[model samples]
Target chain A: MKEMFLIIIFIVASLLGYRVIKEVPSLLHTPLMSGTNAISGVTILGSLVSTAYAVSSGSKFLGFIAVVLATVNLVGGFVVTDRMLKMFKS
Target chain B: MIGTYEIVSIVLSILVLVGIKLMSSPKTAVQGNRIGAMAMLAAVIVVLAYNGIIDVPLLWFAIFVGGVTGYIMAMRVKMIQMPQMVALLNGLGGGASALVALVEIFERYKQMTLFGRLTGQLALAVGAVTFSGSLIAAAKLDRRISQRPIILKNHGLISNAVLLIIILLIITASVANISGIGFIAIITAFLALAYGVLFAIRVGGADMPITISLLNSFSGLAGAICGFTIEDPLLVAVGAIVGASGLILTQIMCGAMNRSLVDILSGSQLNSGINKKET
Candidate 1:
């Protein structure tokens, strides 16, 4: 089933990521957290699709809120991660 | 199952994955982040164009407002406050995913098959938990709430009981086609939200980073479930990558702190004052 396939991919991805992240130093933990937050903002795509297809005013309103919240997550996450990384370099 | 647009979207999402992987390294992190963001933008545009929705002024306006808020906060917040900010962003992401699932459920719950309804419920429960839980984590990090493990007498028992109730309600809501089931589902959601707050607040400050990462993974899982509800493979891929990245970060953090995930979750040092405030 599709769900099972996705679950399998999830495990593989987690193991692969763990292999990579384990090499990172403790000094970068904050930046790593912020950076992953930025990537998770990818949910914005789903919000956009939902907002477009929403028919009723209520659904549209929820979709709109979702869009805005997701945008905040995406933009803020990236900018903050950048700032944190900048600190590391300087 | 295979369309040009889907192929393009999948390819772009893979780039996002590659970007995130690159970000684990210090030398290319910023560029990697930019690559990921660009891929998201590209995928969004492709999906929008394919769906034939080119002009939605309200959507653009919402994005503009959100962009300004995010820009200002990211620029103004101090470095020490990054953890709380990350937690807040994670909460927002989770809340957004839940809202999407709720909208879909409201629009089509009556027509959806059991599988569809189950996916919706999964999205709703996980999303609500991540949203509220991440906020509590942020609050603790910001010192708005006590940073120590907040152990109410019989806390574990209460959480377990509530979780059992939620499971029962979710099953009923998913199987029964009555209006009352909707109400039950709503109450279940709020209870799950409260549980999220309780779960996060019980951890000590020293473990806040791991909690944030774990919550990030929860939000990603919520998003993936939301994708299944909407039948979007791109969303699934993006969510999986974020979820995996969060889990990896959490493991690394736990290892660095010399604690296991189980220890952090169980409030291992709850009343003994073993984890003194880290200055």
Candidate 2:
């Protein structure tokens, strides 16, 4: 039941995302890619939860690394996209 | 009845969608990026609170360090290097997803259902592949590696064999005992990494945009699969959205290049006489 729900969510989200992203112009594809790249850091939520529940020190360490990596991807991606968008504005 | 976490996750996902919707125009793109960042911040906070990990100093420290490093890197990177920078960050994101899936497979192995086990292993493979593929793409884009296609003899056969082995490993890991599962997972990751390298190394500079976009999609798909293992609705939805966005970009790139995705993926375009003439 839960898996089915998740699958539906995935399908719906994908359809909506395709529609929304299609509206972006070719000129903005780079920034668009970077923006979506930042969003992919959504994995940070999973990393945090899993790390919190982790039992072994090794797992915790791995989780910590996951957090750091996701953070870098998120922050760096958004900032870079912002910078690029700003260039267009100027 | 819907729980607080469910409500929050749904609302946040909507906000993220709105953020992306705002990105369609250059005038609103900066604001869109800010909104996306803000939504991410809120999601992180909610996860911490919901999981009661809000006070975990180690997590916070890691975030702080990563945040500082990412900011610095973003500020220092030249505009010419944007493609590589995005590729590098995509690699990191995929790497992180692989790590999370790795830890989760071990942490929940004993308690996990068959579905959980399968999804966990799949995520690990996808994430690992995305990580290595994006890194190679980034290196190629940055000119650290030769921009020419590095096709070995019978490259297609080798990649197909590796992919087959990965599928077998995933199936084996799904049913294996906990002790054996760990070893299987490690081997699977190594193979997936190899596959990623093999897959990316054959694409010349001309097809990098498509390669990057495909890898980007893989990263999101990795995260979405990881979400299934953990049963997180927000992660599943947001990751799917990202995956879809990447796929759309890949399609656009393919159209722009006047090549089929299959031609690009199979490396047929690289050696085609038509390609040379067109270029």
The most accurate candidate by DockQ is: 2
DockQ of each: 0.63, 0.79
Runs in model 1 lying further than 4 Å from the true structure: A1-22, B270-279
Separate clash counts for every candidate = 0, 0
Q: Candidate 1 at A14: error in angstroms?
A: 5.7
Per-residue lDDT tens digits of candidate 2, residues B206-237?
78878988888888889989999998888998
How far residue B246's Cα lies from its native spot in candidate 2, in Å, is 1.0
TM-score per candidate: 0.92, 0.96
State the local distance difference test value for candidate 2. Answer: 0.88
Clashing pairs in 2: none
lDDT of 1 at A54: 83
lDDT of 2 by residue, A42-77 (tens): 999889889888999999999999999999999999
Q: Please give, for residues B1-279, the per-residue lDDT of candidate 1 as tens digits.
A: 557965785687668777776777888888887887788778767767777775878778878888898989899998889899999999999999888888878777888777678888878888899999999999999999988889888999988988888788778778888676557657877988988977887888878889999999888888877877777777776787778778888888877777777778767663343354331
